[model samples]
Target chain A: MTGSAVSATALIWVDGERASALPLPDRGLDFGDGLFETLLLRAGVPQFQHLHLDRLAAGLQRLAFPDCLDRVRNCLQQAAGELQDYPWSALRLTVTRGSAPRGYAAPADARPRVVITAAPLHQDRCQPGAPVALDWAQLHWSSQPLLAGIKHLNRLEQVLVANQLADLPADELVVLDAQGHVCSVSAGNLFMLERGQLLTPALETCGIAGTRRRLVLEQLAPAISIPVAETHISPAQLTAADEVFVCNSIRGLQPVTSLGPRQWHDHSVCRALHEEYVGAMSC
Target chain B: MTGSAVSATALIWVDGERASALPLPDRGLDFGDGLFETLLLRAGVPQFQHLHLDRLAAGLQRLAFPDCLDRVRNCLQQAAGELQDYPWSALRLTVTRGSAPRGYAAPADARPRVVITAAPLHQDRCQPGAPVALDWAQLHWSSQPLLAGIKHLNRLEQVLVANQLADLPADELVVLDAQGHVCSVSAGNLFMLERGQLLTPALETCGIAGTRRRLVLEQLAPAISIPVAETHISPAQLTAADEVFVCNSIRGLQPVTSLGPRQWHDHSVCRALHEEYVGAMSC
Candidate 1:
């Protein structure tokens, strides 16, 4: 329905009411003064509700918003329900320290506000045997532990790169961190093989630790190798890698065919992860 | 007065109309997907309105957001109005890609949502002139052009850092970009001098260009050097520098007395800027 009536609303919680209006100033909007999660749902139940909630809680704790998570969970439950037909939907859970009086000092006494919205999930290309091509982007990620690894709201880098790439024919671009090490894809995490061992860039300092990415590690029994990064990664390490794949919950384990000058087609670990992701999402 | 409030419905706007809520998922709030201006007002009119507008417009352009600034100015006016005289007040003007679909792509058919909320200005710190001590924060900024100089919504960095700084006695901390250059203090811009010739880091590559920063250069005249840059400014650079100061519209210009062994008892540029800022703001 292009213009044919598709209505939506932010299943909102402000102060104590399910109110659509937020009384705080526009600081939260002015700044991405918040954190959010886009979750997957199958049937009427949230696919990884606990994970999303946990992420939001951790992020709010980092953002220093008073723990108003039960209200947030309540809002999410209200918005999410069994979708008709096939299965799967996306729910976005966001929480800000409401709008503060003004400026950046976190309001000590103001209650937080939470906003959640849901949308139908069209099937993604994530599958067991399907392979995907990838490109390496010129943009380098900056090193910042304060902003790194967490799914906080500040992500203009990804949006800009994604927008630029959407114009090109490539499906995804391998982005490197400021120190010229392979960081990840725009919306997914990266893992590659070096001598038949699972290796992903330890996001201890950059790139978000995706819920599905965590699942790919924990849910599965794959033995992996990750860089013990104190800061940036070197390009020498990436060029030496054997196999490469990118992942996120929405599109699990997509095998890379290319990254900048290099090319690698066969990837068994990627295939295994893809199969595992498909089975998990459906179940 | 939290409980004993004589209530009226919070004024809301969807496409500059009187509406209670946004039916569209605003990408601004969604992906930190927008830009905003928190204008100060004494009477009904916004102080530094043009400067604020310029900054907001430039922010929108840099982020590639579909900007409807006049509509936003109208909304900001609606957000701010006559309230009982308090210490200060703020007019928070926010504009976002009205609503986007359930993806990162900027919606093809979208209406920009402009929300303005009026609130009392909170003075969290007193003795405004007692040069606020700053700590060199553990936080580091990442490199990204799409978000470098614009006050876009991806403020989780600020949010996360603000939380950390709250526990400290210092008013704020200076943040370093990943590459070791001094970016900006949280919510303000920085200026340093090596041998009397003014030098500011190039923000074209990163850091928000504060409206007040531009005003400082404009008022300082005599072609005082103001370069947009990213350089590894060693702590030695501050100690060796002849003068240092920080400025934003709200704070005006505050002299930097001590930053990592750099001391300036009475800096002339800072004093001049302070007078000019206060004089201009009073008018």
Candidate 2:
């Protein structure tokens, strides 16, 4: 949320207590041995809380951490309850494998940690902005099936791609995997409209399966009379698509108007789906 | 270093000061947006200090952080000076893009942070253990050339692999890239001896170029007339080698005696190189 009158209260919690800092030995900072969730807190309530927690649970299982899903839910609920003063806010939750010895070998008795941070968001921040300008990213995502679809803490590729966006005159950049397969935008899931069907690149080998993208494919599109599918997409295929949009929890759905040489003004499908999704969220 | 006498005067430095905690918004913890170095501290001196710093500088340049090489060196020097009481120890240095506003896009005025943590090691921890038993890793390394050969913070893959090792009776496990190319062990670099030359996987696509691996390839091998090379190694090639060994800064070299059904007892060359490297480091 940007450029709106907003009163904010920021809170940081480490393992369920109000705290200002994290230990230096935290694996989250040391090895990025963690997962995080960023969602909207509307009127002191977390939106899509179940969906976000589902992803976090899946990531925790994939990383082989001890079962702490119940504790995780409590942490989120506690954080949301603490931000009641702010009418609207952004909430973040991070879970790491706590601290460990000085090597990759995990300690026999590892305790997973949950850190929660919430900051106020302007009421108008989620309003869809102008059609985003897009370009291709210079860097490529690594193809690791084991890490695919989970929002783990290892995100250096996104950081590098974000750096490239500073020099280019574009709002977002399309990222491809090491094999040159169209993956997603630098920070969100991408969907392309082709022949009246919505297609998102399958993340079997790489990329995150974002919560908003999931809702659009499974809920919004079906209600709005559009078919959705997941398949392999190449850069050339992405360029040839009739329309495209990027979706994430923070920004919802953003329509793309241009990608370097190619340009499109038809955002009718994107607009329709976004409108329905927002309507559902507001309810 | 476990079970032995470890008089650890643990030091934690956030930026340059002695601090026990880090800010919650540090990108290193948030998104693994950083790099790290772990070197040996023997007799109050950092082993391979130049090599580790060189790699750290290259990593900083690649990550597009401001040139803080001098500051990093000063931090390491100061940390080392404080840990002089510990006879043997392991030192870790983490450099993150400081604190940032929420999101993948870095702030225009981002400040880089250097964190140093050191813990004492048992004097006998460095003693080469019995031949290691290895099995294939259930997880594969992502082939991201952009991140290959650099020690970055995004290490969830290693965490996953390490978890797998716990169930199996193995000291370490061999990891492969998505395309089935032999990569490295979960915690260190892999080198396979074949014919007369030492062959390790080429890291043009993935894996870290460890400081000890560099010393073995560039220094010990040439000095002892054992040729070295980096190539695309397959599981078949790794299994067919005359001998295989894993190396890292903390542990000089560990001979791999068994890999599933295959086994190797010849470690004369490995013992020679490790002996020479240890003698040189002690000087």
**Which candidate leads the pack in lDDT?**
2
- Which regions in candidate 2 have their CA more than 4 angstroms from the true location? A1-10, A123-126, B1-10, B125-130
Worst 10 residues of 2 chain A by lDDT: A1-10
In candidate 1, how many Å is residue A283 off? 4.4
Q: Which candidate tops TM-score?
A: 2
lDDT of 1 by residue, B28-115 (tens): 7667777777666664457678888888888777767665787777676654543224345555666777666666666656667777
lDDT score of model 1?
0.65
Error of 1 at B171 (Å): 2.7
DockQ of each: 0.46, 0.77
TM-score of chain A by itself in each prediction:
0.82, 0.94
* Minimal lDDT window, size 10, model 2 chain B: B1-10
Instruction: Write the residue-wise lDDT of candidate 2 on A16-72 in tens digits.
Output: 998878975888888888888898887678888888989998998887778888998
RMSD of 1: 5.4
Could you give the fnat of all candidates in order?
0.64, 0.92
